[model samples]
Target: MNAPPAGLEIRPLTIPRTIDDPDAADFIAMTHVRNLVYAETSGHDDGRMAPAELLPNYAPDPAEIRYSWLVLLDGEPVGRVGVDVPQEAGSRVVFWLVELRRSVWGRGVGTAAYALVESTARAHGRTVLQTWAEHPPSPGDRLEPPTGFGSIPLDHIARFLQHRGHQLEQVERISALDLRDGLPRVRELCARATEAAVGYRAVQWRLPTPPEFVDGYAWMKSRMNTDAPAAGLEFDEEVWDAARVARADAKIVDAGRTALVTAAQHTETGELVAFNELVINNDLTEATSQYDTLVLSSHRGHKLGMLVKCVGLLAWLDIAPESPRVLTYNAEENRPMLDINEAIGFEPIGYEGAWKKVLSDPTTAGADTADSSDSSGS
Candidate 1:
């Protein structure tokens, strides 16, 4: 193994009550580094979030046990590490990430940071470890997953994962839509989808979901884990109820972000069968992010996915006109969803690799680790 950089230390991150708390300095600094690393990798600031906008995500939650650490190099914050263990019964999956600045690449910082991630998972009794990393377009040989829907450059990040025994299980496409182009196409698509969805109608609302729709929305949200294309990665079927839905909404509102949910309801039954989400930062200038978009399996073949997405985008235009673009991600193998995105002017911006590693023996994992120079930012 390569020698770790001098003065390297990974310390637990303290979750403050608010961004203004005195203990929030490290968290705030880590947030800045996170944004900088994202901008460096994506070549844009669309993913940037203010310190206040990111604080809520780090706060304690009941659904998952989250562990975070601040990577310090000679007492200066240089990177961040995170591990999340789901609370579902009998779950063994753990998701993790190690993100460092470009200047720290080629050093052993990422490898050392990942050591903490692996140890935390083992301590939590997790056997399946998964992580997602954006592999920006680079001139080099490419790696493709079994799905064969997309490929990522066999860059430094890829080499790092391969060295650590992680397999590239899936590829996700990062897409963007320019809202500045106006919403005429979205309107057209919404109309056509509405026509095709003969028995459904669009229902829209802001955060703090309406009482009548809460149960249905929660049910659909839970289905996202089971219905989405996950390839070889493991996912615990999440259990979401009204309480969980409320907590999720509160988190977004507390973060000073705005979320608009659009769903397609079966008019006759009044059941929410499909849904899409659009979220914008406190700063309206930042790009809007398209969150989970799912349609129930029983409700497929009715153009509900397109209906919800189109309806959501159209509503977003009125909600955050200052936001210039909308960003989204979809599994490469999800051809139906991709077709809708492509037809609606959402262009491919980048690709992300979903990697997985199953530990046969936690005590013996990573015994042959090597140094790698890569930024694992998802």
Candidate 2:
């Protein structure tokens, strides 16, 4: 830790955090500050992702590797920021986590943490120093455009990103289909899609996704970058392998969340061409359906995307009838999938534009499996 230029000094935080340290006071106090500042400044509660009490092991054990430090100004713990470089992130770059404290909000505390975050990532032999901030969308890329979302509109940490030069990339819409309506017609459309692909066909496979197929599924996910737009994302495709695949499976098993999927696979080669995964929230708050649609250059003609979804919908309905709705996000430009979702009755719940900022400098940008694993949380 270098002495932060003159009036400010930044160094590693020495707050003890462990799952067993139930009396984690600094951890708890910091959570309140973070959540308050986050919600007040950003408009949504940030603490919902992980409670302050969870400072120790926000994630499960095997994946249980986390190192963070608190920032202080002249001795008062102003804010805290840390790095979470997962050894692996479901085939993605083990992520980089950077969080800040409130009182230190405008004091160059963030700039200081920014410096520390990069140093930390480099120390771990990681090349990327990624962090997510709610800045406005960048100038180009029709897929993404400016939407008035600053870190927290009324307030704005995201402004820091734009000022810094991060660019906006992908925006996700939360959509839902009232499954209470039954899917006789949706299934029929799926069956029709299956029938239409003469040489190509839709194959429905269930979990116990076969040890051999895990890598394939991870591969399919990594392809989100293909047509899927993201900001500052440098996709590393090699991260997904058999061992990592099994670790993912083991994580799910250990967490006890059931995986139900219906994906479109190549009939001749059995290569997984397109897919969707559905999760049943054990807490029963609501079931989640994550659908990622893809097509190989050779397999582009068939309605495999739609077919897989309909089949997956039926499967989810059958398995988790207790589910109230099915939800997903589609870029507004993606009319084709939108057409299918509409045909099956999924409608927009809310819209949010994904924003990125390179600032003058760029920071590319969670945890846990205690039962619930929302993408934002990790």
Candidate 3:
């Protein structure tokens, strides 16, 4: 870090009244800062897809209080911080995200910004505040990514969090599937999966989930939380129903994104037994993100996960022919999902470390120890 710049400042930003509202001045400035920092650390520029631009897709729950801040140096934005207060009563955890330009990383900008964030959390009567940081692979770790793109160095954020009392909670593998390379293999696997998935068939729709399967889809969505492999992270079984599914579909549509869903239905009972989602932002030329892929335990033996994913990918190729890649993250310990991804030629690219710090009670809460942050960003 260079010599500390003078007069560092943290300014609050207002959330837009509606997604269509013109970008607020502060929000635009923060997005620029985030883009610069992201390019510096990740070696890629995604200015077009900055957080401010994607806010509508993830609008907070009605009862959740959200805050955004700009970290400025000499009156210029250099970093960003975002926080969300839990909406439910008896919940003490507050979720947050932070980023600082690499040039100003060690000069206390992140620390000062986090101080303000902590103050805000405490002011909300929240007891725990947690954020995530990605770490670069160690020297001994395998490297398969082509030159230039590689793991983000873990040292900087690791040291920063440890200095502030955060501890490692879980690690997830960032994996990618090269559509062009896997197209043939995907078809082969899909064929096998179809044969193995006898007595079951798939249903799919673009954005809004079909009305008839909303309830079954909701049930599977809730089961996704409880049935997956979650090793060390604290998580809660999410409450899902038709209403939440409808809202989620609306959010996806509002964001100008298309969701290609391929779900396996139990032909015998007409229930959605397994499902997977592939989301493509308006920019069909870039990589698509793969969201939740779940199969009820009772429906697990039929290879439905692979069947649904392959079908979804095939549909994506037809709809977004220009797409180059698909990205998905799975807990490092989730061998089953990883196995399916690997079978489909999804290669390892990087890793993300989930960190947590529990705040001690103010009357005695240390505000440093981490014990209450949920690992899955709940």
Candidate 4:
């Protein structure tokens, strides 16, 4: 095995209750690095979030076990590691990431950090490890997954993953819509979708979900794991109830972020068959993020997906008037959703690869680590 860099130390991260807490110093530094890494890789600051706006996501939760570490070189923070294990019964899936600054590339920092991620998953009996990374356009060889809908440059990040036994299972398109261009096309699409969705109507609300819609919303959230196109990646079928829904809402609100949920309800049965989410940071001038958008399998063919997305974007304009743009992601194979996005003026901004590795033996994790001078940004 290759030796890790000298003076490199991986220490557990402490999530403070608030930004004002005395123990928040490390958290704040980590948040800054996180934002910097994202901006450096994506060429935009849309993913930036204040420490107060990011702490709630790292808070303790019952449905999943999360482990994080700060990678320090000579006692100075340089990178971060994360591993997430779902609480679902018989779940063997573990999601992880090892993000470092470009300046730290070729020093074996990422490889060393990845060792920790692998060990954590092994300890938790998770054999299926998965991760996603943004690969900005680069001129070089390209790699395509089995789905054949998108490709990513076989650059530093790809080589690192390939050397460590990970396979590229899928590619996702990162898309954005300029709110400055106005929502005329979106409005037109919404009208057509509304006419096509004969028996469904759009219902909208802000985060502490209304009492009447809580159960339906929870049901759709659970379906997100099963209904989405995951290619070869594995996702636990999440269990969501009113309590879980409340916890999720609290996380967003506590982070000083606002979430708007737009769902399509069946008129006769009063079931929320489809839904979309739009979230904005405390500063509305920044870009808005389009979160989960899903329509139940049984409710397909009614144009509900387009209905919810168009309705959500239109409503979001009024909610975040100053927000510059809206960002979103979709599996390349999800053409129906992509069609809607394209029709409404959302263009492809970037692409990301979804990678997976199945450990044949827990004890042998990262034993064949590959030597690469590449940085994996968050």
Candidate 5:
């Protein structure tokens, strides 16, 4: 895809995280605007990570989230994005997240960059690419999202995804796990477990995911992924086990994000039932540090979720005691999980909607032709 007219130039942008600025005011102003944009669009203002985290992600064994971009003309940064593509052993599909600057609406930056993402997928011969998003603000919604967390709407971004033949297949809610007051007792944490009668057990899988278990982990992912709540699911739903998990690790570290934390549970039958993850610095959106969590259906009855979650919760909190929260998203309709959330004091912040388009390439589907032949032609 080519750039549209009006003196627009779309070039991949880069920044060095190691450098510091002498213009404290401009630096702070840029950050403030950046933050303002964030609160307006995504709903949170990440004031941490000093203004320098906005650089090329190139660290070894990186955090869980990663960023890459394309800058527009006029230099104020029209559109840039962060992607999390780590290869973890037990995962099935490759995932990505793209955040755009709203100023460039109607511009081609999104279309072009989306094309690039497609090109990369083609290069790898991958089956699907997954993205997570929130519902858009309402008609009379204010510019600033409230202090809590919520789903960003899919209205605006959906147009782009729909234009590309993407459709919403599922929706998940994002929730935060904060340990600001320190973790509750282990017994208190264990009270939520559903494992006793089911013979299921949960435990935190430590960093440096053990190599011997990779293949089996990859095997289960295909059957494991629940549907995405929004459109544009681009990965194959296949059995995942160890190899998939390994890919997640390599993908993140390769992109300068870390995949250092995880928790999982197994039945006495040795079936992998539940899981959640805590990233050291993969995501930098919340003013305080945060992490992501995942739970599977097979493990739902066992209270393994709370059990598995608490491990990673206390784990990250133990390491970065200064951090405020660990973030996770559950489907808005997911009430059982919400029960566990309320017990832990995770508050609501913002809300996002999920949408999907079932049709693609409308022209390919055969459009009705307009009658251009006028009687005057006779």
Candidate 6:
């Protein structure tokens, strides 16, 4: 897992067709490159992964069209790219991830890799190709003292993506909350939210959403697509139902992760109005992710978002007390959620740019005009 040696020739690397069947050596090399590139880009240590951890995520989801490649130089992996194409009807969206070793950055490797990803996605009848990029905020932006939100330096990836015509869609602030700092503020917020939500009660569950609440939960989840500020990115409202929710829950469980969800219920109507989720993988001692936190448009003013989030955090702490921090990303423009996050002691660590590019229009063959936009923290 040491760094690949220098003085290698630059060329397009052929992707292994059956990476899921990788030999022990190939698996080790791929994981090494993935972690190395991730660390270099984010300035953080990539958590150590056991063999089981790698095996579980090795195969692509059967329900979606997926493509991936390891960028190799002189027979050594130096980067990687992956594309995820969902199977929903009338949906032409494609999600992508591209990472390269710091040594090969600014050398046209990433640009070339993206060109391949773009063409492949277009060939697959995908209209929208999107990925997130980590970059520094503008100089004019202020960096809050406790957290370094706007202080990171701009890197080559941002410029490379721009050169390839990908527009910066949305700027997302990456924030972290240290659970060890105590949840006094969070508890206070929960109290205020509960008081404000006069006729609402909070509910908590671990994965496999209760059947009775499935319909209400689906309704709230669908609203997240439409109600959240998306800046200018073009994304269709995702269709959600009990089946999809169950499938998602199953996937999380299959990946050795536990989902702790807390929801707000209308005391009078017995309907769920808001919910938040936190995911903790098998490695409970590391970090947990704050997944979705949505408050329905009809139920926004009562601080339900804050309440569900607080409830979820407390629930997570009880279940996984070994966790040190919880991380979440919010669109810089999402002031309401950002305010709630800040009030709960979450501090910004960095920013992410949601970049999108429209490939050839599915309806128009050979159409070369590509549209680009950025929005939301995804």
Clashes of each: 1, 23, 10, 0, 74, 6
- On the 0 to 100 scale, the lDDT of residue 349 in model 6 is 75
The global C-alpha lDDT for each of the candidates, from Candidate 1 onward, is 0.89, 0.54, 0.71, 0.90, 0.47, 0.70
Shift in Å, residue 58, candidate 2: 6.7
Give, for candidate 4, the lowest lDDT window spanning 10 residues: 369-378
Q: After aligning candidate 2 to the native by TM-score, how far in Å is the CA of 286 from where it should be?
A: 2.0
lDDT of 5 by residue, 1-117 (tens): 324436554444344434453433333333444455455565564433334443323333322334345444465555444344444433333354344556565555555555555
Using all chains and alpha carbons, the TM-scores for the candidates as numbered come to 0.98, 0.64, 0.85, 0.98, 0.61, 0.82
lDDT-wise, the better of 3 and 6 is: 3
- Number of the top lDDT candidate: 4
lDDT, residue 361, candidate 3: 61
For candidate 1, write residues 1-378 as lDDT tens digits: 566889998899888888899899988988998898888888899888888888888767789999999988999888899999999999989999999988888778887888888888888878899999999899979999988878999998898888888899999999999999787988999898989999899999999898999999999999999999999889999999999998899889988899999999999999999999999999887899999999999999999999999988887877898899999999999999999999999999988999999999765655646675755657
Which candidate, 3 or 4, has the higher lDDT?
A: 4
Number of clashing residue pairs, candidate 6: 6
Across 16-102, the per-residue lDDT of candidate 2 in tens digits comes to: 455237555556555554565445433433223234233423433444255666555675555566666655454323344344544
RMSD to the true structure for each prediction, in A, is: 1.1, 8.4, 5.4, 1.2, 9.7, 6.1
Which of the predicted structures, 4 or 5, would earn the higher TM-score when compared with the native?
Answer: 4
Misplaced by over 4 Å in model 1 are 363-365
Off by over 4 Å in 4: 374-377
| Poorest lDDT segment (10 consecutive residues) of candidate 3 | 369-378
TM-score of 6: 0.82
Compose the digit string of candidate 3's lDDT tens values, residues 327-357: 8888776788889999999998767766666
TM-score of 1: 0.98
- Model 4, residue 45: C-alpha shift (Å): 0.6
Compose the digit string of candidate 6's lDDT tens values, residues 1-378.
112235333343333333455545555566677777656555664234443455445454444666767677777778677777877677778888777776665455555556667777777788887887766445543322112222323345555555555666677888999998667788888888888889999998887788988888888887887888776566667778888777767757766777888999999999898989898777888788898889888887998888899888877778888888898988887889999999999998777877777764654444222122111111
